[model samples]
Target: MPLWNVYHPVGAYTAQQKQEFAADVTAFYAHRGLPKFYVVTIFHEIPESSFLIGGTPSGTAVRIMIDHIAHHAPDPAARQQIDDSLTRLLAPHTRDRGLYCEFHIDETPRDLWMINGLRPPASGSEAEHLWVRENQPVPY
Candidate 1:
């Protein structure tokens, strides 16, 4: 029942919106029996130069984002949900265009840990024996 991580690059996310975003992740994970533990979602606003489609800077980045997410989500149900959430979050923050975004959702049990830290459950030192959850699947 831990929180998942999402690495995002998008448009419209602001400093003030951080809380809402966090809540979004919390709710996202909790929906599936997760406690919405501790998510580390980073939003990277793609600058014009950083974004391109068909050799053109996307004038409507939101659509592009939706499409992109669609391509990544292997699950149809999850695809729609993810697209909807991302689109909703970007709509208010979009400028001339909207958002061309990508989010690496690390909520699967197979994605739980690849720890480099010496912490108890993720250590490589004498405490390595204590490192647990490593054999576990990535928590989604």
Candidate 2:
């Protein structure tokens, strides 16, 4: 599971733009063989007075925190690839729009994660494939 938390200044994105951005984020994970339901993107609107950069309020800065539970980079090369992919994924919504963005990914132990009180099946396993097809947690 890749849970993305996006924080941006209030009024930075319209409802339609938020939906599109979330869709893009979700597709990125789905393309990697994760169940679509495993991807979640949350948009947080920060009040101008509350967002800060260099100790001063900034309206153009965006922050992203990503939690990766089901998959993780096993080596430096793989980690770099993930970072590059995320950079490309965020370009349109941040760089192209003149927004300053910073993001970091944290890999959580998969054993500690659960959905609907059930631990997920192994990656690429038949049971996991069923969850992908169903797009929800299912008894294995």
Candidate 3:
């Protein structure tokens, strides 16, 4: 599974923008072989009074932290592609609004995680494909 934690200042994003962001982020991973259902995106709205940048309140900054199993993007190129895709895909949501944004991805070993009470199959394993097929909850 892939988990995205997106943080932005209050009033910076519309409801539609949040939905599109989630969908787009999910698609980015699905195309890389992860089951769409297992991708998760979270949007956190920070109150203007409480948000700060460079020791001052800022109205236009965003930070996204994504975590997933190592198997999802085993190659550096694949990881780089996701980062680039996120930068391009999120530009309209941030830059267009005069905001700055940053995106980061962290990979965890599959053995260190579990799903449905079971550890996911190793990357590229036949079982991994079967598990995804049986558990996928959305059509790509």
For residue 62, model 1's alpha carbon misses the true position, in angstroms, by 5.2
Task: For each candidate in the order shown, give its overall lDDT on alpha carbons.
Answer: 0.42, 0.95, 0.77
**Pairs clashing in candidate 3?**
none
Give the TM-scores of the predictions, in the order they appear: 0.43, 0.98, 0.83
lDDT of 2 by residue, 36-106 (tens): 99999999999978998889999899999999999989999999999999999999999899999999999
Stretches of candidate 3 off by over 4 Å are: 70-78, 136-140
Order the candidates by TM-score, highest first — what do you get? 2, 3, 1
- Write out the backbone clash pairs for model 2: none
For this target, which candidate reaches the highest TM-score against the unseen true structure? 2
Error of 1 at 105 (Å): 6.2
Model 1 stretches with alpha carbons more than 4 Å out: 1-11, 59-140
- Give the number of the best model, judged by lDDT: 2
Q: Give the total clashing residue pairs for model 2.
A: 0
Candidate 3 lDDT tens digits, 1-140:
78888889987779998998898888876776666767888999987677787788877789888887735665889778767877888888788778888878788777888766666666667766675677643222
Model 2 residue runs over 4 Å out of place are: none
TM-score of 1: 0.43
